[model samples]
Target: MRLYRMRLYRIALWVTVPMALPLLAAPAGLTAVRAARDTAPEGAPSVWRPGVTAQPVDAGRPFPALGAASMALRRMVPRPAIVSRAQWRADETKRDSHAHYAGGVRAVFIHHTDTPNGYDCADVPRTLRNLYTGQTRDRSWGDLGYNFLVDKCGTVYEGRAGGADRAVVGSHTLGFNQGTTGIAAIGTFGPGTPVPAAMEHAIAALAAWKLGLSGVDPTGKVRLTSTNGKSRYARGTSAEFDAISGHRDGFATNCPGEALIARLPAIRGLAAEIQGRYARAVPFPRLAATPGNTHRG
Candidate 1:
């Protein structure tokens, strides 16, 4: 969606450090999860819907040190805690017959939830749960559209039911979901409202890991075909986009907002660094495919 730029402003605070997982210091009164779960259909893929527990796990954990030999040969992949679908109370009552899997990763799309930005970091799980409810129950979509979500505090949560490491097709970006992954920031970002440093880092780390899986460069560009005329490109049109791009790049919407969109360059650079883009690349990982282009999702 197209978002008009506004001249509003908000003071931005940044905590730029090597974020670790396992334990984190958090603000008080942020210890509640507000969502419910219902039984999923039989034979459906398993979901880890344990409900939101406490604070979210950090998605910017450093990658394990590659051995001296491996370091020079292989790219480092960040290990973000893609909080499983089960972690949040995913009510799969409306889950579709199956999820779609892309052949491989070619690009990454960024987006914003346009939701309230004043929420505490701890409430992210509940917010995501509510979002899933709306998408599946209200909108009648098969599942959450985005592949992953990043909270204001920089935590990454798994969005769709497919494996986070896989190029799982999603409903996000409409005609451009195939061969791409959608990452939505869980807050509205207007012009001049500085995007949080932690959130940016998380997005970078995620892009690095996902794109690097196929040796794709975040600083590079790729050609994607548009399947819907409603999008910025007419159906069957091939458009070139930065490896890391905003939702607005493909569709005619003010998605991902100007503030967050502006930070995409830095995010792309950081993601490249995380993926060791400057160094020699390694072979792409091999994964078995589940036939069928139509992602029943």
Candidate 2:
């Protein structure tokens, strides 16, 4: 019999069918299943949904997600309190996949630390240090994946090994790390958990600076390829995404959570404003047309 899977606007299938064949099944059943699987269209989400558009993914670097406007890869916003690896007192005992490098920044992904949010502002250093220890020692990542982290009081801590202004590739967003930066909001923000206003502004500032580096508008959207089939998107999928997006947009997790995700539009707008301010501060050279040449030189 033909099968179909249904999807809601913001929801996934309630159950996922196992792809592996059952060993206890009889030969006749196995043969029928194999024939059905082989007959399904390529890149189908599953045998049950042969016609639904399955999200694509890729194992290689994802394509750059950019907006309508293009700009030079110049740093525009000032680097905020980017705590270095040494500053975070990271434990270098863990091993991980080698660092990946990106040519320039294109987007900023928002995330949540999934940790407590009640620490004093002055204790941010310790919090960051602990985070580094956990990610490196427990998770076995070479470095903390987030490019920067924002605390409830609006304090921003630099993450990973590279300099804050550099296009440091991160492991934060599964399948879409290249050409993007990750900013983790240090708290589990669900119902009743108020996202801090200062933290939101800090995130906006960071997004403004990072996206501005690649001439991207925070309020715009860009295309990115998915490298991990396990993510919300399938491998080889080229999806257009907001320049400022939550981790959930790229992966199958509740990172950046509901509260932070709710504030993304405002954050994106504020980032655009910050970018505009920076652009105005540095005026571009006016090209004048010479008498002998029709082209402005």
Which of the numbered candidates is closest to the native, going by highest TM-score? 1
**Candidate 1 colliding pairs:** 1-253, 1-254, 2-253, 2-254, 3-254, 48-86, 48-87, 49-86, 50-86
What global local distance difference test value does model 2 have?
A: 0.65
Deviation (Å) of 276 in candidate 2 = 1.0
Candidate 1 local lDDT, residue 54: 21
Tens-digit lDDT track of model 1 for 1-297: 123223222112124444466654333424332221111211122333332222111112233254432122325596776677777767766667566665457789999999999987776778888898887777665788889998766778899876788767677776677678899999999898878777888888899988877777888778777756677887667889998999999887889999988888778877777786754222222212212111111
TM-score of each: 0.68, 0.67
Please identify model 1 stretches exceeding 4 Å from their true place: 1-76, 279-297
Candidate 1 matches the true fold with a TM-score of: 0.68
- Which ten contiguous residues of candidate 2 have the minimum total lDDT? 32-41
- Please, what are the lDDT tens digits per residue for candidate 2 over residues 1-297? 123333442234334544575544332322121111110012211123222221112222332334312324554777555545565565555423334445567788999999887866666677777777776666645567687887776766778755677776666887777678899998899866887777887888888878877778787778887666666777667899998999999887888888888888878777776676433322322222111111110
